[model samples]
Structures are given as structure tokens and as C-alpha cells.
Target: MRRLIIFALFALASIMAPIANAQWQEAYNNSGAFNGFHFTDSLNGWFSHIGSQKIIHTSDGGNTFDVQLNVALPFNMYDVYMEDNLNGWACGTNTGSGPGYIYRTTNGGADWIQQTHPASQSHWIQIEQVGSSIWFIGSQSVTPNNLLIMKTSDNGSTWDLTSYSQFDASWLFIFDSLNFIVYADEGLLALTTDGGNSWISTTLPSDYQVQRVSFKDNNLGYALVANIWSN
Candidate 1:
């Protein structure tokens, strides 16, 4: 299955247009469910399908999109991240039992090369990058429901692995080695103050649920929270 993607284009064309007057214009919608998308700029971007090993791209904003890469059969892309219009990576699995799979493309998704990893059946669901080449991925092993964070410094040539205790978290935010954060369980955030050596979970009040999370400094951050049952 895939999900629909909606792109919003700013409705401002003239210099005299007020910022409040700008509206969101519907841009693109695919036929099937596409799980992930990343826009390098207003004019270039790509989206990935959940199944059938497909990654679609659009160079002219959301006006059009074309399949840039598609592998053989049975490969599912759960997440995709592009560093720019020319360099990016995607992650998923190829079978029911997954050791996780990572693919790298240096030529604007014209060709994707599968990067190798160690022998652990992890189905990666989220991909993120730090700086130019350091990449991180979140994965869950199929057999035992184990979760892991995979990191690579030089593209995918080498990887460092860390296993954590959360099975339902999908977000990875790295802010140097000493301070890093990932999603904890259902309503928590996993924090690592001493790098990946150890981790602890924190959460907000029961009435609020974090819809999104981000951090700019080691101790400063923000969460988009929603009042769940508050009256």
C-alpha cells in the first residue's frame, strides 16, 4: 500500500502580495500510495512508493513527476532522504525477513546503487543524514521486533550500529555525538546524553501528545504538541 502526497505551492506572484494573502495550491497526487517524499528545492524533489521498488522524481516543481529508479520486484521503500538534487539515499527491505536495505544515488536518482550492511534482519523505516555524508537509519527486525539505529560516515562504505529499547519510534535527530534524540515509545522521546552508549526516555503530560519533535541545541528543543483529552 502507498499513501497520497499533497504539495503546497505558495500563492504569491507579485511583490505587492501580502504574505498573509498567500494560499496553498494543491500540486500533485499519485495513483497509488507513496510513503515518503523529499523536496530539495521548489523545483526539484522525489517521492517513493511503499512497494514495487519505485522512486519517482520531479524536476519542475510539482507540475510533473517521473519514475527515476525502480529495481526488480518485491523491494519496499519505507523512507527516502536526499541531500540535494544530485545525492540521496533510500532504505527498506527486499523480503518478508529483512536485514534492512540501503540504496545510494549520487547522480540525481538516475541510478541507485545498493549499499551493503551487516547480517541483521532489520527492516529500515526512516532515513536521515547529517552534514554531507553521515547517514542514519531507523530499523526494526522482523522476527523478534528489535529496533536499531544504523549509521554510516562515508556514504554507505562503513556503518556503525546501535541497538535501542524502543520498537515503535521512527524519528532520528542527531546533534553531534554527545547529544542525540529519537522517538521513544508511543508518547515518549528517547534521549542520549552520552552519545549512543546509553539512552533514557522522557515524555510530556498525559493530556498532551507530541505530534512532531525537533531540537536546535543540546538542551533546547520544541515539540508540536496537541491537547488530546483536554477540555
Candidate 2:
């Protein structure tokens, strides 16, 4: 989601004059809202809809989409990450304190099966795939007191969940399989280098806070920050 702004700015530039053979076109009906999507390549991709339990897939870019799979509620996926056309995962926040839900498809969305994870009754809003590890970050929605990070290094066969208390944010940026950053609120950010086993907290100045960050490596990165009194 953090990278969306970068894409939007680039889109605006191209849209002003159009690009050779590339143009924006409608891919779906104007009926309901589609929340998130992932594409394995230019021709194969999938999109998940809100307000429903259905997921859509298209092999010809966005020209046509077929109903791929349906799962349980909160009835919408927060994100979908397709490693390829054949293997992928989707996740979302649950309703009314239900267990955080994750769905996996190993056969190109031919079938989507729910996978079990270690966060007992949590809400997952983000899923990132780094190498063989599938990482998820979520909480209870009511509070970040139950912030949970779930990881699976060997596909969906096994999962490792670690919870961190005293955090007030949900978004996380994984620089690699083990090194990443998570917002800790109150002008602080948590940095993890051992696959979230431990954290070294860094406090920002009294007047600034960082909302998002991207890392080129452990020693170099960039952040989107704002003043404490800004809107």
C-alpha cells in the first residue's frame, strides 16, 4: 500500500498524454467494489472483492475474469499475493473477534483452501511473501495490544506466530526475510533483524513520526514522515 502513491504519481504522468499502445480500460462491471489484487505476470492475475466472498481471476490481463473461489466472512480479503499463477495466498480481518483467516491456493485458483495459523482470533490486513516465508501482520482491530506476526517458511504446511504487545500500529515493511520495520507509534519504530525474534526500538524526535519506510538494505532506507501537529 505504501508504494501505491509512487505508482499513482507515475500513472498521472502517463495518463496526461497517453503511452504508445498502453491505455487504461475498464476491467470489471460498475456493480460492487473490488478491494485488492495481485498479478503473477502481465496476463495472469486475480482480484478480491469486498462485500462478498468471491475472488476473480483473469488470464488475459483484465479483459475477462472468471470466478475462482469463495470463502467465509468477514466476506472480503484485505490483500492477495500471487507468487505465480499456481501458488498464492489471501487474507483478511475477521468479524467479531473471530480467528484471523488465511486462504491458500496451490493450483492456480482452481481451488482455495483455508490454512490454519497460530494467532488465535486475530485480524490480518497485510500479507508479504519473502522467499519461502509467508508473513502476516494483524491484530484484534479493537486494539494493538494483541499485535500478531505469523510466518510460514515452508509454504503453508507450518506456521510460526509471535505476538508483540505495546504496539499501536498495524502496517509493517519487510526489507527481507528477516529484516524489516514496524511502526511502534508515539514517535517510534521497531526494527527487527532476526525474523522478528527480537526488536530494537528507535525513538524519533519529539516533532516527527514516520508512517511508512522502505529499505535498500540494513544501513540505508527512506521513510514517509510527518510532523506531530500536521493533519
Task: List model 1 lDDT by residue over 63-177, tens digit each.
Answer: 8778877777677788788988898988877776767778889999989888888746777877766555455555556644656777787877777886665444356667866
- 194: Cα error in model 1, Å: 1.5
Per-residue lDDT, model 1, residue 4, is 21
Model 2: per-residue Cα lDDT over 85-128, one tens digit each: 89988887656675767888899989988888766668887788
Q: What are the Cα lDDT values of the candidates?
A: 0.70, 0.74
User: Which residue pairs come into collision in candidate 2?
Assistant: none
Give the winner by lDDT.
2
Per-candidate TM-score against the hidden true structure: 0.75, 0.74
Cα-lDDT of candidate 2? 0.74
Q: Which segments of candidate 2 are over 4 A away from where they belong?
A: 1-22, 31-33, 141-144, 184-189, 197-212, 215-231
